[model samples]
Target: MDRTGKSDSGSSSMTTMGMVFVKAQNTPLYSKAWTPSTTGGYASTCIFLLILAITSRMLLAYRTRLERSWHDKAINRRYIMISGQTEADRERQAVGKGGEKTEVAVLTANGTDERVKVVRSAGRNLEGKPWRFSTDLPRAALFTVDSGVKYLLMLAVMTMNVGYFFSVLAGLFVGELAIGRYTGAGEGHH
Candidate 1:
């Protein structure tokens, strides 16, 4: 305005156009400008993705709990006397119904089967055994899925929108607060 000594409307309009483009830069993925039509749907999508990422993390915590529980049950066991011998015998000979010595196989938490001296008690059965830890194949598949989801959520957050990124973080924080206690993170804390 000072250089030309005249009021200019063109410059003001150009400034407004720049502001519009700057706002549009934050549009959600696979979306157009943040119009009324797209706003609700995009917001819902972001919230869902964030919740899914948080749920996956929580599930990972649950899996770890299961692993720890299994370890405690298997290795930290009480002394059991089988066939008139203690666990110090390493392997106990058990006579089958047919009077033949049989080896008892137990599935360890690590998905590998181990031979253990087992007593046939009323509380024990093959189908009633404790839940086994996730096998390598299933664990790998879960990791892949979780990683893919997290990365996608990160990318959505990288779009630099206040709504999407904050939603993701809120979900994570809320999930931690909700399930952290059951996953051992609440222990030994004041």
Candidate 2:
């Protein structure tokens, strides 16, 4: 080991096997093409990593929003079915009298009939095909992008550059602090 605790294999390469964090400018981040040759280039790489981390959090927020929307739609559909009301009926009810928003109570009383209806509805919706092209395609695309960003960040961290690692961490912190509240409590962690 050398003075910096890095193994001295007489190779003089910028890459090291040491566990210690280094600020080497020649370190490749994410890809060989991203190797920084100057202080400015290194700083830019750190900033890019930070931005990428923040973007990952943003994608998570968007995915959460999309999921909530789907849940709301499902609930609305169930409500319509259980109440035996058409969309036009609901709209007319909403526009009744003084323009005040009326809350419609959902019937959840225990009964075999209601349970059977719910089960039938669920079965029809599923149709033994859980993956619908309309819904699952967008979801799969979002997951793919999210996974790609996460893996990219992981690769950047594997570079073992102190500044790059901290930049990504700071981005995550800032992103969570800024956009996390809108995603609801404990939603982004998953």
Q: In order, how many clashes per candidate?
A: 0, 0
**Candidate 2 clashes between residue pairs 3 or more apart in a chain or in different chains:** none
RMSD of each: 12.9, 10.9
lDDT of each: 0.55, 0.72
lDDT against true structure, model 1: 0.55
The residue-by-residue lDDT of candidate 2 on 26-45, one tens digit each, is: 89986688799999998898
Q: In candidate 1, which residue pairs clash?
A: none
- List the candidates' TM-scores in order: 0.47, 0.64
Which 10 residues in a row give candidate 2 its minimum summed lDDT? 115-124
Q: How does residue 83 of candidate 2 score in lDDT?
A: 52
